[model samples]
Target: MDLSMDPAYSITKSECVELCAGIRGEPYSVSVLKEGYCTAQSDGTFRADGTISLITGPRAVLVDTGGPWDRELLLSKLKEKDLTPAGVSVVVGTHGHSDHIGNLNLFPGATLIVGCDVSEGDRYLPNQLAEGQPYLIDDHVSVIPTPGHTGRDVSVLVKGTSAGTVLVAGDLFECCADEDSWRDLSENPELQEVGRQKALMDADVIIPGHGRLFRVHRTPLN
Candidate 1:
């Protein structure tokens, strides 16, 4: 099947973990933080904000903190799981949207990893440093520039776990299972496709900006 031509290429939900596991490799155990959709009232309406937390070695890295709507709820959930805000050593946003970055202020001490396109002029909270290119938070975890949903869009990848590689795709796919949600990716189909290709190649576990976690078959497109 020409998966690219298929709209399912945009968003299709299956037991990705199981599917990827069958591909002769370990699949990462993923936890979907928030799962739902949001609407944008203006020209820049980016929806599907959520969070993904990955335990890479001794450090815990967070990918994209959801919106103010779920900030308190998310915080409660983190606390319940015994994951304190202060304990997070790395906090990364897929992009600099208000929704994705709403709760960023909660993690004051974590290194703020962002894309090269994101400028210091950007409205980040105090004590946050904007970085460029792919950054390694640890020996096993890194944040890569995906840049499609927005100029600042990024994806987080965690390696060296039994669960394989997990890609926390903030707004990159927005639940690659919903057809209507494809419009939320970006108007530029080419960029969105590039982001899709990146996700497919880099991640075994595909964690969307919103919705439950799934696994992806990493095909070497190059």
Candidate 2:
């Protein structure tokens, strides 16, 4: 679904961590698996949105495996959560960057879904998604393209409850970590701005690429 053509995904200039859309029910839980540190920036600022998300379900999906060095931590976090890599059937990336896609060697058996296409004969299995469209992996998951952090960058939106939405954002928002950090990280400022707006409008709970999990709540008007 092209969000641009779809009016339903309205753009809201939301204030992060201010609005509180509390978790209603845990039909599923999104565990933030802290991973590797992102490489330093051009301005000598060290940043890392290497955090990965583990969405627990009948068939689990591991979103963004951290850098190569983060393998131990990622695996330990999964073990703590009882999610063995063997059980991770789907491996989806928000974008193809070193820190984000570096840990792919861990899950050889899982289905690979990412920005670029890949194939190694029958040894490798891949699912390449269409650009500018939503990839409905299942009834509950949608991979929406938000080209800002990187042009091919995308974010994963997972349904938390019948009325609630969870956004697994990869490098989209670095949290309230710094105002300029997000702006600095954006490859295309205009497009990144647009994507951020849609995410704020549609997502109930946002799992930022580098920061902690946060919720978006609106104080109802009478």
Pick by TM-score: which candidate is best?
Answer: 2
In candidate 2 the C-alpha lDDT for residue 72 amounts to: 89
Weakest lDDT window of 10 consecutive positions for candidate 2: 16-25
Worst 10 residues of 1 by lDDT: 19-28
Per-residue lDDT of model 2, residues 110-200, tens digit only: 8776654433324544444445777776777767787888887778888865337888888787763435567877889788878876777
Clashes of each: 7, 2
lDDT values for all models = 0.61, 0.69
> What does candidate 1's lDDT look like per residue over 1-222, in tens digits?
123433344422354544332112222234555554555767885455565454433666666677777678778867765788888776777777766777877887776765433222344443222343576665666667666677667787776445577777777777657554565558565676776765675566767776656766533332
Score candidate 2 by TM-score against the native.
0.77
Each candidate structure's TM-score, on Cα atoms with residue i matched to residue i, is 0.71, 0.77
What is the lDDT, from 0 to 100, of the residue 84 in candidate 2? Answer: 87
